[model samples]
Target: MADIQDFKSTPKYETFSYLPPMTPEKIRRQIAYLVSQGWNPGIEHVEPARASAYYWYMWKLPMFGEQSVDVIIAELEACHRAHPGNHVRLIGYDNYSQSQGTSFVVFRGK
Candidate 1:
């Protein structure tokens, strides 16, 4: 027999963003690519002092299916502007697996 606690686990996929914030144009291209792969985008943020915290709040709900890159860019920009002094991340969720497929830090500020 196995302990039931063994069944508890964190998300399997939690991709981090690239260092050195990407230009909006490049970010747009990446969003286009992810959308093509059937992934949806979402936003998350954490305090600079709590960078390693596990309680990142949802800045935006998951978006999927034919969503325009422009939409994602808008949300990204909004998140950046709102939390310029914190750490913001862009996450792509995989609907098929209902798990986070990838993520990246979009902004870093003190």
Candidate 2:
């Protein structure tokens, strides 16, 4: 028999999701935290039925340094509208290391 561990599966990335989904207010708070940490925020999404579903496409340019919280919220809304039946996520990039430092699935639309 093959090794059982080899048959097991794992997620491609570490992504956090809000159970019961997050309200707009909660999302704002989370974004606020990222901004306070001096991280850049960006959005990405993937179609549920697509092959290699784990792969995500960028929805907007990364916002770095201090930015208008409302703008982030607006972008989030636009992503939701554009991909009403897909999964959308938010990622925070640390400017210093130039890598993704935090991420979460902000929407799960079916």
Candidate 3:
């Protein structure tokens, strides 16, 4: 199980497996995990594996201070590497302010 309590406890490389055919329970749990970062999902949609697109809407999770991007990249990369079968790909990024963290990440998963 992914320890949701470990968010602010000094993030480290971690493995996360979002269930195939993404279940409601799994999605809910993932939302909860992001909530630790002050993220709240407003919309979430999934398409078939053919298109390689996934979109999620989450409330702005403000990020203060520097090095936030590095931390997120490290974690996402680690999780992707750990689960080779899951075709994880970063699709887009949009952020207006460092203090106003992004709550959503558009990714492709197989």
**TM-score per candidate, chains pooled:** 0.73, 0.75, 0.26
Query: Cα lDDT for residue 65, model 3?
Result: 29
Residue-by-residue lDDT tens digits, candidate 1, 1-110? 24222213421113433133468777777788778878888888877777775688789666656478887878877987988887777788898998877777766656
- The digit string of per-residue lDDT tens for model 3 on 1-110 reads 45344545532221332322344355444544554554322222233242234443222332222234445444445544554344432212223332323333223344
lDDT against the true structure, per candidate, is 0.70, 0.73, 0.36
Stretches of model 3 off by over 4 angstroms after superposition: 1-67, 87-107
lDDT per residue (tens digit) for residues 1-107 in model 2: 24222213423223343133467788899889988888899988887665144478889777656577888878877998998987778889998898878888777
Q: What is candidate 2's TM-score against the reference?
A: 0.75
Q: Candidate 2 clashing pairs?
A: none
Best by TM-score: 2
Instruction: Report model 3's TM-score to 2 decimal places.
Output: 0.26
Model 2 score (lDDT): 0.73
Better of 2 and 3 by lDDT: 2
Clashing pairs in 3: 62-101
